[model samples]
Target: MVQTFLPHPPGARLALEDATRARTGSPVQMGLDELGTPLSQTTFVVVDLETTGGSPTSSEITEIGAVKVRGGEVLGEFQTLVDPGSPVPPMITVLTGITDAMLVGAPRIGEVLPAFLEFAQLGAGTVLVAHNAPFDVGFLRAAADRMSLPWPRVQVVDTVKLARRVVTRDEAPNNKLGTLAALFGATVTPDHRALHDARATVDVLHALLARMGPLGVTHLEDLVTASDPVPHQRRRKSHLAEHLPGGPGVYQFLGPRREVLYVGTAVDIRRRVRSYFTAAEKRRRIGEMVDLAEEVRAVPCTTALEASVRELRLIAEHDPPYNRRSRRPERRPWVRLTDEAFPRLTIVRQVTPDDDAIGPFSSRRAAEECVEAIQEAFALRRCTPRLPRLARAGASACVLAEIGRCGAPCTGAQDVPSYAVVAGAVRACLREDAEPVVAAVHARIATLAVQERFEEAAVQRDRLRSFLVAARRTQRLRPLWRCPELVAARRAADGGWELVLARYGRLAGTCLVPRGVDPMPAVEALVATGEVVAAPTTAMGAASSEETELLADWIEDPATRLVRWDESDTPLACPVRGAARHAVPARG
Candidate 1:
């Protein structure tokens, strides 16, 4: 997702240069500010294609025409006839005034496509415009793909969509190229030929943009967004995003009683929050969520990672009605080593204080895979929950026990003292010492491959990879538990720094330092106002692995600089030989 954010302050409208500078260091930030890019600076490529027939798959490009312009001045032009490699239909010839003789010696589509692509991308940033964008762009993409050429990543604008949004039917009879050209009094009229139609569409594009100027559609992104039709009822509530800050932050949609409806994070809170009310919002449930929302709230953060972590925390805290995922944290399954006489591995939701838990995995299946990998490493009991206290004297043993895959404590075939060593090794593997389990899994994978059971081997490989990822994540985060205070800084776009302070892995306070500002006073003020977060008492809520991982990611970002810490040494460092790093190899 290409997330967008405004600059430093949340509520202030920024000048183009200022907004650009503010978002410089952040990767997710993109130009969405209404006035960020001037109309005069943008390049527009008006394109039109006369194809053999309707479908690009069946029909081929008969002619290609385009005009490049910037600030109303035509910079260059492209026009070509393509040998479509098929007979041009009589109906298409009558409509476009191009016949077989006209294209007799013209370059084929394969030869024409590359030159067309180069022409379309003549400017630093180009937006392709057409009467009906999909038709022209579709044919171009189809022809390019047939030649095994990569399609250009250019923004496309449809004059039809633009006219539907900006001009009422009362002003224009209909949204056809000819009708629109006459209605807008365009000097160049559509003559059905590619070049003439493209020129006419160019005029229509300018006309639509002129109509959009009053709606605050100054930047290219703003223009594209405005072209989307928004629900009338929803448009009235767009005021909720009017004052949202432009920087990285989490935003919440609130209901009548200040209840959180949906929680989301964005690099540009205003742009993202405002999108919920637009026609581009296709999710039916989200439209329903917006209908219930009475207000929108913004909480600023220093970086994209911080926004993500804050979103997780907020979702967990509120368990909001509209939020479907991450709201029910208790529902996320974890792989736990049961605290019974035969300590078998199990997939569980509720985490008791005595249980050793590995994760709040995305699903029960993932947690099951982790447990299966651990069991494969050590022949732990694979019986159903709560096995007979001493195993029924004459009970039947399952195939797993017969195959030596399980210790078979359920059938009295294995004793508790003997099982203890396997369970202990499993615990060791789940914690830091993962070599024993890794080697065992590698051997199993090798044996399965030797037996030509490649599918089963792939499954085992994934399982082992899952266990290693969780175990390494836990080990890397273990040190943060001992630290009382942690503080770090990331450089801002304007030569300043943003500060983050956490106490015992919980975010406490944040402050920003402009390039030359004194840091001491602001630091003191921030710490004084910072809230003291209490540690989680429940095993399910312990450590908030998601937040810790987010923090670790933020700390590791190259833009950040360590400012101050209450501890003598920073415990947050990436492990050199961690299993997580070793699990995947870089492809050449």
Candidate 2:
């Protein structure tokens, strides 16, 4: 017969008694809690656990301590020191004061858990309480697992979390057991015993919960808890890595099949998927996202660009509940610079081949330098064309031309040469290729270093940065993982589309574009160049016209992908089905 300090009692009248029964009857569940809503027979089975070590997976429970509190009063308790079937570590011995010697003749967890669980069920609907419920809950689950038992669906309360909200995140002097005990005035005297810790946790919960008025800490059933609080620092209970696939894809979270909660992307699908579970609270954004999710699903793409295009496509296609930004096609700005006799900087709403003004500079200083560059290169006048009548025409060169900014363009001195200089600078600014600019800047900075002109060298550094910014404007916007030029077009046969590869210039190979992979749903042609710009279709009911899958086939090959943007010189790298260059008819 099972030995016990008290007689077994009948189940309570509340419905939640079923929950308590469920936990204990499941053979070996993590722990037991009183069931029932707060308004109906609200009470608590406050519990705590002392373990041989911090880890539940590797460590065993040395003791299980519990007590029942009803109507704001302690009803009864059952505390036991269990033989973990392993030697207690020295550190645990020092802290918990439980040793191999103390547990030599004690009942093993298997021998005593039934009686413990039975007593807990007697007060079913008792809200399980612990400083950090996960710690208690984890060991309980571990104990159940040791006996090949399933974890029960029992509720819990975490005083540690309660203190975070009930009191304040940072106001507490300490959240530790002793500190909390002191805060709640529950500590009779500090001691490191299992009963002492359990009792202290109860005190902390009692004090903290009482103070949580209007902050919603009243009801026991409504509070979230776990029998195990200090679970392992891992995503899965067993600490195994969440396996994921390595490919381009879009991922989604599901709460039952009806609710599509979150959507995300990854080039290496597995790494991205696994991150949701492994990310820590320190990564607030990701953690918050994961918390809202239940299950994950991914759709594979052959290439990163394909993944990207498909990712955007699916967001608009499905409109997953968790995505915050707009999924429809919209316009974003691009920086451009203009060419002039004395290059002037200006912003443009759009970029086309005919435009060569000064700057599409997102950075203001970069635009100013574009003006300075024109003046320095072509010796052009920086002064207004319409100057005051009071000043003589030949008195002095314009601001720039006068100060050797140009070869005196104000008085028409070296007008041809000055204009030529301006032309060179404008040309340099317009060149999207940055290698030349970086080389020149490096040479110039090196020259300044030789001259010991550190300040000038600093200016050169800034200038170089400006050059790089202009150079990388488009490059940075486009992910490097996408392959070269891929053309998704209407196929001649079945009215569907096929994505074709253009190696350098000519269409040579093709692949079937998968459904729902285009990021830009609308097909757009760059106004001046007649080249397709992947944009969402603005027309009503238009399937994303641009082919998103054309390049997926050739992305892995070295010889297929090429650059084809007619007006842009931005060297792009794509896997295969993207822009590629091939030899063409020589221009006149």
Candidate 3:
């Protein structure tokens, strides 16, 4: 009776009696059955080659042996010896037993290669297998290139790699074919001859396939990648990715309790999700999450922008433990001029329409650094306490005034009107122009460097960088926030137009206009049915700062074109020159 293996979890019955089925057949089913050929129906040509030397570039193939098998039944065999066009080395003759006398009457590789290629490529679904495939295939490819013949494209599997993955050291001493053939009790032992080794590899291949059956590698596609160093536990979960769409989308890993464990975006959902179970996924935390994951859900999108926006929204909503970035958009900090008499810079979590804010900085420390840069550039007051409308009689000035860092309006030395000049420069630096502030900071840094106070100059330089980065981010996002509605389009990767509608700096809706279709109707339909975003109460508008930043990046891409702008007063332009122009020159 022929033994049949059913796809099952670990510890389940590994074999069953099935006399009617093929020897290596299995009642296998997988989620990607439609896309992948079943292993039971796959045709594998186990091949071996004996060469004159180790390196293909310096060597010539002496002998070629291949056995074509399907479902554990031998279909045909190919065996040939090729003259090396040179005398055989004594060492090679000793190792492979192919002496000069044996090769004298054999055909040249150019003649034998064509017949071997024809036999190996029986038709579609033919895969080339060998004990050490790279060594054998490399020789064949080099010979074909030297002979000016087109090498046929075929999937090659190395039994040496497969043995390393399936046969543990305890089961076999090493991954060499001789050891593996002995361990698997192959009828044909792998001698130094090519045909003998090729026959032995066939038996080892079937044994390894049986071992992979319980690991859910029933499809030829899965079997091809089975040699990867991914753990069997993770490999078992690859079926979860088989049903994902092969397009741009967001994917969520759901735990056993159905709670989302992680969320991510990818251009090809199936390919990206499948990578998580392969050796390519190096993140330890994500591996842990995958181990506990029970299901994968996909949210297909028309374009990459839609996919990324959805990923951010899902991360914010679920607060998945595995996602460390963009999880708490509410906690992002902003630098705003306080609505006080002095109008000092303050780091705030929220903003108001009337507030003159420059950021939604990445962190409180970053916002503080930007405030320091602005305060250093201008004589803005550093004191946190609010000053009275009129200075009290006998009020003492703070130390900032002595250091020339403040205007000292508290002691009445500089009245509100005089202090207003410094505040005006600050407001200009934050909102309309940064050149004056950047120039002032650059001058200070240059002076400090001339004095050889390099450490202080470096500190000043860092502060200036923080300020410029925050300025650029705020400037880029500010115009979008003020605009009530905007429509933009970019050429999609699929030769379509990706139309996006933004309302108050938030992505209201997006759609893809298929290639050769009129995009105007899609744009009109998108705008008409998009979310009706209310006027923003803050500089960040209806969306989180991170979301606005993402939109800003997409809009600034060279491929994106502005189709419509609803608010004429708020022209989509950054009044301030970009920070790149004022980059502080490095000191000698």
Candidate 4:
């Protein structure tokens, strides 16, 4: 999610800067107070594309509109509607005032792409401006990628970001292009159309440039490069204020030898400053940051734009371990099979987003092929959640458990091995045969009644029936499909063996294998080897009889390519799967 923070209004910043300049004969800390910003005197084009409707998938682009500004003046413009090659909705036509008739004689996207590209790159290099550049850019990128057309690396600027820095949060809380233009005292024309918005964007930009003063910032790069402010304030005497004035920007608290101790911010100047300097105030988050503070300093902005920029910059610059700690900490659930010895193959959560828990296979392949590992390993009900209270081990569990169908928790003796099996089974049922899982509730109740545990069993029996009634309406039995196995199958950057897969095989009817184990450690055996074919079936050299001995060759191999990226070539991502996207790879 590309979140946006409103920048101080340029007008407000300009007002403050003007006041400062009037008093000190120099620019004080204003957003556009120039240090170095990319400058271009060439024509700048602010563009927008209105789709047939809002959705990118169902709706298609209906109009492309733009306005050109050059040498602080308005140039020629472009606006056209292309037949979306689909049925247009009435609501869309009503909103955009663009009817099917209007687009019937219009050009197609193929012709439109080249035209826009030509207009954007009129001369040698051109600047493309968009209020929300990424949204427009995403479309352009997707369209280009789809058409296999190369998009020129033209300079681009996102006015939304610019406005955030230029406007104070309160001044322009709403940073919509139309809202911004109106805030700038520009005419508020009817909006939601492509061309009007672009024209208004140009007007707003011109007003900002005029207020910002001469830099010949024609392109978006110039505006951005220019946005970086210069610090020219008189150096502070030791005792006074060494920190940045209470302004909205990023802050860094440096420790001895410039080590970063803590990084944080305060919305209020005196409060944030007090949090650092005052003994009582310096206890919690601020206290921690202040304790390590050798130097306290900051950049000032009228809005959170500077704050966000500085925060991200400091995080990248310092690379503080504590700062980037994962919110979703690494903690995998394990079924220990307490019955087994030290090297018990535990079933852990599948790190992948697939439904692969259905296994107690001879191999990962068998689980992927069999698709019952989830049920066998977890003992999850075929399709329904376990009944309440029944989940807690007790006498009820004993009655059901006595029948051999369940690993009961009710009585003193719970089947430890069966518990492990059922746990994996439950996971599998949920993953694959969801509806059948609910159907198994009857099976649970039936087992409970065999021991004359009628009361306890009957209550469960009723709940299971209700559950089944509810579940059948919602979860239909879908085809049991196997999730793709996209394991990276890593080898260590340094040589070593990882006993990732404890062992894959079966005991009794319940085939048991360690599900959701990290394959990286096991692949450590593969080392730097690029292609790993299954180990050759060879006569035992006596040493080969031992798993340790079997791992010797891989343990010894160093120059082998241990791991490869599962998808595109990138370093292995760890914490492999969780509630978040794009996790950092786990350290050994």
Best by TM-score: 3
- Give residue 567's lDDT in candidate 4 (0 to 100): 27
True-vs-predicted CA distance for residue 223, candidate 1, Å: 3.1
Ranking by lDDT: 3, 1, 2, 4
Better of 2 and 3 by TM-score: 3
lDDT of 2: 0.50
Clashes by residue pair, model 3: none
lDDT value for model 1: 0.74
Worst 10 residues of 4 by lDDT: 503-512
User: How well is each residue in 54-153 modelled by candidate 1, as lDDT tens digits?
Assistant: 8887888889999999999999999999898778899988888899989899999878888987877833467888888899889988887888998877
Best by lDDT: 3
TM-score of 3: 0.86
The TM-scores, one per candidate, come to 0.64, 0.41, 0.86, 0.34
Candidate 1 backbone overlaps, count? 8
Q: TM-score of the candidate numbered 2? A: 0.41
Query: Hey, what RMSD does candidate 2 come out at?
Result: 17.8
For every candidate in turn, the CA RMSD to the true structure comes to 9.3, 17.8, 9.2, 20.4
